[model samples]
Target: MAWWMSSSRSEKGRFLFFVLPSLICWHIWKARNKAYYEGVQMRLGRICHDILIDMKGVVEVQFNQRLGVQTFLQLYEGTAHPPPCYSVQLVGWRVTEEGTLTLNTDGCSKGNPGVSGGGGILRDSLGLPLFVFSTYFGETSSLRAEVLALATRLRLCM
Candidate 1:
């Protein structure tokens, strides 16, 4: 793993360096549970195919496109055709009305009922940050975390 991280020479290689290990571990854990609980036999080929499918799903979600599963497999096998070009969009904060501030908040969870957290920043009309906060919400759904984040930020306004 150390060698692989050190040898990654491209941005794509670096991105995969961080993503592949955890993804492989997750699949292996799922296979272990299925075998132990359901008496299902595990096959190396099946696991490999699953990993490819999972990676493809991730890429499709990120690129917001429905690409074929073989696209990701061919990438690792050194036989992939070039992917379609993606356009970049510029994003900026819209200035708030005078005398008012903007609060941007975000929240996330590890699993549906897993550990969660919420955070927010209070920014002025000119986009300067006035306050920032983050809090842990032991365990909750993603929707709950988001609601909690918004509520917490709203509390600050009140």
Candidate 2:
């Protein structure tokens, strides 16, 4: 929250930074309720889109009359949308004993029960890749995806 506020200091920008948290939390809470009580699947993309729509409206109504429609729209677009950030980390891999093989795997889900996948790699004692596999489980929990990845590797070993 502090980082977001510090990124922009314009009057409208400050307003957006202030109300952004409330708008985000409200939509997320509503989505959670809808998913639990209504048995609807929650989609983050849809929730974010809805939040953006509300933010746009709030900016327009509060500033448009005085700032003019075009200026308000520009401010809304610039301040409401945060800049994209990307990061990378280098991980060191450990080698197995000379007589053994090692396997590493991972799983991920976009929205818990939405769009799941797993992948793994097997390496010889020398740390040379021996086998690799990737698969899409399609709409499953992260735990299930992880289990599936390990199971697939076990089956390959057998």
Highest-TM-score candidate: 2
lDDT of 2 by residue, 14-115 (tens): 888788899999999999999999999999888987887787788778877333333434555566544566799998767667879888999888998889
Q: What is the C-alpha RMSD of each candidate to the true structure, in Å?
A: 15.8, 16.0
Q: How many clashes (backbone atoms < 3 Å, residues ≥3 apart in a chain or on different chains) does model 2 have?
A: 0
The clash count of every prediction, one per candidate, is: 0, 0
Residue 154 in candidate 2, Cα distance off native in Å? 1.5
TM-score of 2: 0.48
For model 2 the local lDDT of residue 149 reads 86
Q: What C-alpha lDDT do the candidate models reach, one value each?
A: 0.76, 0.80
**Candidate 1 residue-wise lDDT, 65-146, digit = tens:** 6754374445453322233569999979888788788888999899998899999999898899999999999899999999
TM-score for each candidate, following the candidate numbering: 0.44, 0.48
